[model samples]
Target: MKKVSKVFYITVVLVILAVAFGAAFPDQFEEITGNIKTFVATNFGWYYMLLMSAMVIFSIIIALSPYGKIRLGKDHERPDFSTATWIAMLFSAGMGIGLVFYGAAEPLFHYAVDAPTSEEGTGAAFKEGLSYAYFHWGLHVWAMYAITALALAFFQFRKEEPGLISATLKPLFGNKMNGPLGVLIDVLAVFATVFGVATSLGFGAVQINGGLNHLFGIEIGFTAQFMIILVVTILFLASAWSGLSKGIKYLSNTNMVLAVILLIVVLIVGPTLLILNMFTETFGLYLQHILEMSFRTAPLEGDNRSWLDGWTIFYWAWWISWAPFVGMFIARVSRGRTIREFITGVLIIPTLFVSVWFAAFGTTAGDVQNSGIDLTQYKTELVLFNMFDNLPLSLILSIIAILLIASFFITSADSATFVLGMQSTNGSLTPPNNVKVAWGVAQSAVALILLYVGGLTAIQNTIIIAALPFSFVMILMVIALFKALSKEVKSGK
Candidate 1:
C-alpha cells in the first residue's frame, strides 16, 4: 500500500489558491503583498540584521571548535562525491543564476544611480558599490546556508533522524516535532523553498528574455517572458523525471564549465587591468567594512534607509528564504565530511569565487558606464547584454550568456524539485517521480503568476514575506543544533 504525507496536499492547496487569487486579481494581490513586504522590512529590519550577524559568528565558532571534528555521517563513511564535484553541485544549486543575473547590474546600479552611502558616479561610489555587492553575496549569505546545512546534515546523517528541517530541532522539542507542530515546521520549509526557487526562476527567465531581445530583436515583455518560463519549465520537468543523481550532477557540472568560460572571456576582452585592480582593492574593502555593513541600519537618513530596505534587508530575507532548499541540497551531497571541513568549504570557496566573478563582470560594466555612456537605460535583465556590447566579440558573449542562463535555470529548478519532493514526502531521498513532477509544475506556476502580476517587484515582495516566518524557524534550528552538539561533545562522540 502507498501512503502520502499531509504536507503535500496542504501546500499544494495553499499554493494553488494563492496563484489563483493572484491570477484573478493581480493588482489587489500585488498591492497586498507589497504592503506586507514593506511592513516586514521596516519593522523587522533590525531583527534580520542581528540574526544574520549571529549566523556568521556561530558558523565560524562551530567550524573552529572541538565539535568541528564531528562527522556529518558515521566516522567510517566516506564522502559520496569528490571535492570538486561537491563544490560544483553546491555552488550551482546555491547561487548559479543570481551570480549571472546581478554580476554586472548590481555594482553598476550603486555606482551610476544611487550609491549606498556615497554620492553617485564618483570613484568613491565605485569602490563602495562593489564592496557592498561583495558583502551581500559573501560571508553572510554563505553563513546562513552553512548553519542550516550543518544542523540538518548533523541530525539526519549522524543521529539517524529523517532528513527534514523539523527533525533537526528534536533536541529542543523532543517528540513534539513528531506531531502537528512538526508538520507545521516542515510545511514552512516547503513553502519557503517553493517561493524562493520560483523567485530565482523568475530572474532567470527575465534575463534569458532580455538576452534574446538584445541578440535577435525579440521584444522584452510579459508574453515573451512567460513563454520563456514555460519552455524552461518543460525542460526542467524532463530533467526532474530523470531523477536526482543523473539529472542534477550532469547539469551542475555543465553549469560550472559554462560559467567559468563566460567569466574568462569577460575578463580577457573587458578591462583586464582594471578588473584585477578592483578585485584586489575591493576584496580588502569588503573585509575592512564587514562589521559596519553587516549591522548598518541607516536609522537617520530617509534615502539611505530606503536603499537599505531595498538591497540589504531584502537580501537577508532572500538568503534566509533560500536557505532551506540550498541547505538541504547541500546536506544531501555533503555526507561523511567533518563539520569543520563542511563549513570551511561552504563558506570560503564560493565566497572567493563570487568575489572575483563580480570583479570581472562588475568592473567591466563600471568601466563602460564611466565612458560617458549610460548603461542604466536598459532594464536590469538587459544590463549584462548592454555591457557586453562595448567589448569585443559582443555577439559571441551574448550567445554564451544566454546558454549559461538557460543551463542554470534548468539546474536550479531541477535541484529544487528534488528538494521539495523530499520535504513533502517525509524526507524520502528517493521521492516518487509523480510527486517531483507535481512540485515542478507548482513552482513554475507560482513563478508565472509572480511575473504576470507585478514582474520583478512581485518576486521581491513575495520572497520577503515568505522569508519572515521561516526566519523564526531557522533561529530555533540554530539553538537546537547547539544543544545537540554540546551533548555529543560531552559524550565524546
Candidate 2:
C-alpha cells in the first residue's frame, strides 16, 4: 500500500475508536471534553488572542512588503478562474453556513448581554454588538486563512512541492518531512480538517433542521438533524464526484447570487436606513478599535471575562481549527495569483462582504427587537427565521433562506471532501473518487456522532481542543515559509 493509504487507514481506525467511545459514554465524553476545553480557554485565552493578533499583523506586513510582488506560480501564469468565481468560491468554502448561522444571532446575543465595554440594550451596547460581530468575523479570521494558504501556495506552486501542511514545513525539518515525523503531521492535519469541517456540518445540520421546523412544523431533534446530514452528505459527495470545476464552482456562483439577493431584499424590506447607519457607525468603530478589540482578553475584563472566553476566544479557536481546510481550499483555487493579490483579496473582499451581511441581518434583527418583536427569546438556530417572521413575504423568504443554506452546506462539504482527499492521498490534486467518497462518509459519521454525544456544545469543544496543537503547527508553517522565501530571494529565483 502507498504511504498515503497507510495514513488514511490509521486515521480511520483512530476516528472510529473515538466515535465508539463517545457513543458508548456520551456523558463522560462531554464532561471530559468540556473540562479540557475550559482548561485551555481559561489558561491560554491570552495566547489565542495574541496569536490571532500576530497573524493579522503578519498578513498585512507581508502583503505590503517586497514579497508582495511574488507570484504563487510562475511569473507568466495567471489565475485559473475568473475573479468573481474565485471570490465566490472563497466565501462559499470558507464561511458559507457559518455566516448564515450567526448573521443575526451573534449581534443579538451581544446586544442582549452586552460586552464588558458597553451597557445592555442601550445605543452603546447596540454599537458594541455590531462592532464585536464584525470583529469576530473580520480580518483576523481571514488573516489566519491567508497565512496558511500563502504558505501552502508558496511551497506547492513556487517550489513544486506537494500541497500538504507538513510538506510546506519542509524548511524546518528537511528530510524528516519525508519520514515518520511527516506522516504524523499529515495525520494531525487530517484529524483537524475532519473535525473542523464536521463541526461546520453539524452546525449546518442543526440550522437546516431548524429552518424545516420553522417552515413545515417538523419536530426538531437528533433524528431530523441526522436525516438532514444524510441528504446533504449525498448531495456533496455527488458534487465531489463531479469534480471541482463542474460541481463546486457552479454551486458557489449560484449560492453567491442567492446570498446577494437575500441581502438586498432584507435591506429593502427591513429597516434600510437603520442598517445603513449601523453599518457605517459600527464599521468606523471597528476600524478605530480594531487593535484594542483584537487583543481584548478575559484578563482585562475583570467580571465580564467569561463572556470573552465563551464568545471571542471560542471564535478564535474555531477559526484556527478551520484554517487547515479553508487554507488548503484557498491555495488550491489560488495557484497563479501574486502574493499581494491573494492576501489582499482574501483579507479585504470577504471581510467587507461579511460586514455588509451582518449589517443587513444583524442590525435589522436588532431593529425588530427594539420595535418589540423580542427575537432573542428564540433558539439561536431559529433566530434568523424568527426575524424573517416580521419581514415581507415571510414564508417565501424563509424558503429562499433554506435553499441558500442548503447550497452553502453543499458547497462547503464538497470542498472539504475534495481537500480531505488531497490531504490523505499525498496531496494529489485530483484524488481518487473512492477516497473522496470515504472521507465524505467519515465526516458525516463524525458529525452525527458528535451530535448524539452532546450536540452543538460538544461540537464546539471538540473544535477548540483540536485547534490548540494546530495553532502551534501554523506558527511553524509561517516560520518555514519565511525561511524558504529568504532562500529564494537570495538566489534571485
Candidate 3:
C-alpha cells in the first residue's frame, strides 16, 4: 500500500511538472490552452454546472438538517478556539486575498457586463452580482470543504482513518485504495493542491507588486516577485514552526480583525447608502432567480456560454480543486461539533460575508464608474488602491490598505501551507509544524515560478486550464458524499 501511494504521488508530480513546464517552455502555450478550452467546453460544459447546483442545494439541506447532528472524528473533544476564533479561522483561511483581489472589481464587472440573472427583467444585474459572488463563495464551496473536512475530522480524529483524501474515499473504494485506488485519489489531490496553491501564490505576487507600484511608483519585475515570495514564505514558515497556537491562531486572528476593519472602512468611507441599497436588492434578485442563474448556459445566442465557462464554471472548478486542502483544514479545526453547526458556521456565515464584501467593494466601484470616474486606467489589482487613493486622508488610508493586502496574502498562504501539509502527512488530524513549513515553502516556490513565467493573467489562465480534471473529480465527490451520508443514516450510525 505504501509503495502504491508513493508511486501514485511520484507519477502525478511528474505528469503535472511535464504539463506545467511543457506549457511554460513550449513552442505554443496557446495549443495547450486550446486543448484545455475544448475539455471544459465539452465535458463539464452544462452538466457540471447543473451538478454543482444540485450539490449546493443538497449540502445546504444537510447543513440545515437535524440528522446532520453527528460530530466528526473520534476525539469528540473540542479544540481550544472559541466560536468567534473558529469563525475567524474559517474566513481567514478560505478567503485570504480573494477579498483584496476581487472586492472592488467583481461587482463593477457584473454591473458593466451584468450577471446571467440580469439578462431578464426579473433579476437586475447588480443585485445578482453580489448574490452570485455569495453563492460561489458561500455555502456550496464550503460544503465541498466540509465533505472532506468532516470525513477527515471524524475518521482520523475518531475512527482513525488516515488523514488523506484517499482515506475519505476508502469507504467507497474499500481496501482497493490500500492498493492502486488509494494512490489515485491521493495523487490527484496533491497535484490539485500544488497548482491551487501556486495559483494563489502567483496572484499574491502580482497583487503585492501592484500594491507596491501604486504606493512607491516602482516597476515590477523578477525582483518584486522574488521579494514577495521570500517574505510570504518566511512569514508562513515562521508561523507554521511556531505551532498552531502561536502561529496559525495568531495570524488568523489578525487577519479577521484587519478584514473587519477594512470592511467597516469601506462601509463608512465609500458610498455607504448606495452599497446598502445594492446589497438588499441584489440579494433579493439572487434568491428569486437562483435556479435560472445557476443552470443558465446562454447557448449560441452569444458567447454567453463562454462567459459562463470563464466565470461561474471556472469558479466552481477552482473551488473544487481546492477542496482537498480546505476540507482537511476545516476538519482539523472542527471537533466535538455537530454537523449542523459546522455546516452553518463554515458554509453559511462565510458566504454571507462574501456577499456583503462584494457589494460593499464592487458596488462602490460601479457607483464611481457610473458617476464618471475613469478608474478603468487602473488594473484590477490596483482598483482598490485607486479607490483608497481618493480618500481625504490618503497617506493613512494607503498604509491601512497595505496592511489589509498583506494580511490577506499572509493568511491565505499560511492556511494553504497548513492544509497541504495535513494532506501530505497521511492525516495527522492536528497540524504538525514540519508539514506546515514544507507546504509554505512549496507554495512560495510555485508563486515564484509563475511570476517568472509571466504575470497575473498567466496565473489565472493556468488555474482555469488546470481545473479541467478536478471538475470531474468534484462531481464524483458530490456523489460520494451523498452516498456516504445516506449509508450512514440508513445504518443508524
Candidate 4:
C-alpha cells in the first residue's frame, strides 16, 4: 500500500514538474507566475493571513498556558539542548538562508516601489515597505512553524503514529488519514521543501560564489555552485550518519556561532545609526499597519509597480511555500517548550534578529545604491560582491561574507535534509540516523539538479507547486490542531 501510494505521489509530482518546465522561457515563466500571484492575492490572500494569524494566536495561548509541555517523550525526560542554544539552533535551521537573503533587501525594495498596502507618499511608502518584511518574518510565519512542530511532537512523541503530517492528521480522520491521504501529505511536504530550499540554495550559492570571487579574484561561474553543493552534501551526510546526538547537535551549535559572528560584523560595519533608527520606525510602522498590511495582497492593477509585483508578491508566495519545512524544523527543535514558548521563540526572536540584520545590511545596501554604486548591473552571483565592494577592507568583508553564506547554506541544507528524512521514513518522530542521511543526500542531488538545470527559477517553481496541495492540507491541519487541542484540554492532558 505504501509503495503504491509513493508511486502515485511521484507520478503527480512529475506531471507538475513537466508543466513548470514547459513554461521555462523567461516570458512564459513570468506570465504564469504573475497570474499565480494575482490569483493568490485576489482570492486566497486574506485566507492565508487569517490562517497564519490564528496559528500565531493559538501558539501564544499555548506558551502562556501551563498545558503545552515540551517533553522528550510522553513521560517527560531531561532537556535535550540548552534553551538559548536550542533557540539559536532552531532559528538558524528554520529560516537561515532566506532570512539573510530577504531581510534587508525585501523591506528596502518595498519602500522604494511600494507594497500592495502602501498609500501614496514617501512616508506611507516607507511604512508599507517595512511592514511587508515584518509580516513576512513576523508572528504569522512563526505560527506556521509552531503549529506543524507542535502537531508533530504531540502526535509522534505522544501518540506514536510515525510522526509524519499524515500521522498528525490522524486525530481528525481516524484511520482514513493513513494510506493515500497520509502519503499525500508527506509527499506534498517533500515537494514543497525541495522547491522552497532550492530557491534558498540558488540564492545562497550565488551569494557564496560572489563572495568567493570577490575574495580570491576568481571569475564567477558554475564552479561555486558545484563546490557549495559538494560541501553541503558532505557536511550534512557526516552529521546525518553521526546521528542527531553527535551530528545535528554539533552542526546546529557551530552554525549558531557563525550566525552570531555575521550579525556582529554587520552591526559593526554597516550604518549603526540608520539601522537603529530605521528599525525603531519600521517596527512601529509594522505594528501600526499590521492588520491592513497582513491582508494587502498587492492587487494586479494598471497602476501597480512591476517591481513590487515581482519582489513582494513573489516573496509572500515563497515564504508560504517554505513554511512547512521551516515550521517542521522549528517544531522538532522545540521539544519541552510550551506552545507560547515555541511561538515566541519562532516568531519573536527570529523577527528581532532578522530585523536587525535587515536594518544594518539593508541600510548599507541602500546607501551603496544611493551613492551611485549601481548593483543592478550585476547578476545575482554578484550581489554580495557588489554590496561588499563599497564597504571597508573589501577582502576581510568578502571572507566574512563567504563564511557566513557557507555556514548558513550548510546548516539550512542539513536541517532540511534531516526534516525530509523524518517526514519520509514513516517511523519514529526522530527517525533513524540512516534515514536522515538518505534524505540529506537526496536533497543535495535535488539541489545539484536544480542548479544544473534552470538555476533559481526551476527550484522556486518546484517549491511553489509543492505548496499548492500542502496549503490546503495546512488549512485542514489547522482544523485538526484545534480539534486535538480541545480534546486534550477536555481530557486534561
Most accurate candidate by lDDT: 1
Candidate with better lDDT, 1 vs 3: 1
Residue clash pairs of candidate 2: none
Model 4 residue 399 CA deviation (Å) reads 1.2
What does candidate 4's lDDT look like per residue over 263-320, in tens digits? Answer: 6776777777776787788788778877775555445565464544355445555766
Q: After superposing candidate 2, which stretches have Cα over 4 Å from the reference?
A: 1-3
Candidate lDDT (C-alpha), each: 0.93, 0.90, 0.68, 0.65
Q: Would you list the clashing residue pairs of candidate 3?
A: 72-154, 73-154, 73-158, 74-157, 74-158, 127-282, 163-426, 163-427, 177-182
In TM-score terms, candidate 4 sits at: 0.86
Off by over 4 Å in 1: none
Predicted model with the maximum TM-score: 1
Position 252, candidate 2: lDDT: 98
The better candidate by lDDT, 1 or 4, is 1
Model 3: residue 55 alpha-carbon error in angstroms: 2.1
Candidate 1 has what TM-score? Answer: 0.99
Tens digits of per-residue lDDT for model 1, 28-118:
9999999999999999999999999999999999999999999999989989989999999999999988999999999999999989989
Give the least accurate 10-residue stretch of model 3, judged by summed lDDT.
1-10
State in Å the error of residue 406, model 2: 0.9
